[model samples]
Target: MKHPMPALLILLGLAIAPVAAQQVYSWTDANGTKHFSDMPPPPNTASAQRLNVRSGVTTTQAVEEPAAEGEPAAGSGPAMAAAAGYSDADIKRNCAAAQKNLERYEAAKPAEDEEAEVQTRYQEGLSKVQSQIKLFCG
Candidate 1:
């Protein structure tokens, strides 16, 4: 004996799938003008941005800040920015997360594993957590 509710629910989900399946495309034309289209871009053209046109889905991109005169190139400079203002709860959560990550990395010795990639990742994660603690907990 097979229950039919699960199969009916799955069928209902499939029926409503198309209502949330719209895709949007953004691309620049030959004149450097940006355009958004419902259809995909033609082949051999530049890469286009794609967005899923669903409720509460935003299609926006981050703007890059121009480097100051004394600042180095983007990739060459340190990744950490000045600490931003955070609420008390946010600060507490950040500090706890950083401490937990640091402790986890410390307890798990990468040397016990033979993979160089794992050791490198462990070191990187430990450094990131240390920096996070300094930035947030201080």
Candidate 2:
């Protein structure tokens, strides 16, 4: 069984949805060009300004802070879930398992993309499985 391309994309997108805390550091350089970093820039002659990092940011790629010992943002899904009461090793293992489960759901797609029944079942299954994982894991 294989799902339609669009459905697969949706599944992957859902799998990857949800991000962590994001801080945007916007500062104008000596040349007046703005720059962003996960951390405050080192002492520079450039004009620097700090912007408040917001919570519950989703979509934007999260650049790890430079040695800030930061915790997982408020709602970072698997990353946040793994951070609580789990060692780095445990987090890696659980995260890998969660992803593998998602992939398995993806693999169980229907063969006929045009079949409404088949498509619905596959989508429903995928959605349910993903929701379960997030609820239990995250």
Candidate 3:
């Protein structure tokens, strides 16, 4: 009987090929939040670096400064959403959800006993939802 070792090795190599080809990026946003994702940051993001998945090596790429306050970064907006593998319909759905959350947060009233704690949680949730709105609706 023929040994199956070589065939198994070939199959293993094929299984690893896609993972080897995947890319990871690391960058700090304008708010100084460091992020790592398969998607590259916006073009105007500074200090962007590409990471090798297998070797854990990182290579820095030249990048421009972050966009001005209240302005979207280059390659951001809807295109960035697409690049992040989100379809138009997905973005729309998420945007609507975020809007609903924002409305709920705005209309909510905390109980008098736990008002401070509830208000803090509400503010945090609202900030996250608003950020999502900007990302999905822009």
Best by TM-score: 3
What are the lDDT scores of the predictions, listed in order? 0.72, 0.64, 0.80
Q: lDDT value for candidate 1?
A: 0.72
Clashes of each: 0, 0, 0
TM-score of candidate 1 on Cα atoms, chains taken together? 0.37
- lDDT for model 3, on a 0 to 1 scale? 0.80
- In model 1, pairs of residues that clash are none
Per-residue lDDT of 134 in model 3: 82
Candidate 2: tens digits of C-alpha lDDT, residues 88-135: 676667666766778997787678746898798788878876775673
Report the lDDT tens digits of candidate 3 across residue range 74-107. Answer: 6666557767999889978988988898888878
When 1 and 3 are scored with TM-score, the better candidate is 3
- State every prediction's TM-score relative to the real structure: 0.37, 0.33, 0.43
Residue 82 lDDT in candidate 1: 26
RMSD in angstroms between candidate 2 and the native structure over all alpha carbons: 19.5
Identify the candidate with maximal lDDT: 3
In model 3, the runs with Cα more than 4 Å from the true position are 1-74, 109-114
Ranking by TM-score: 3, 1, 2
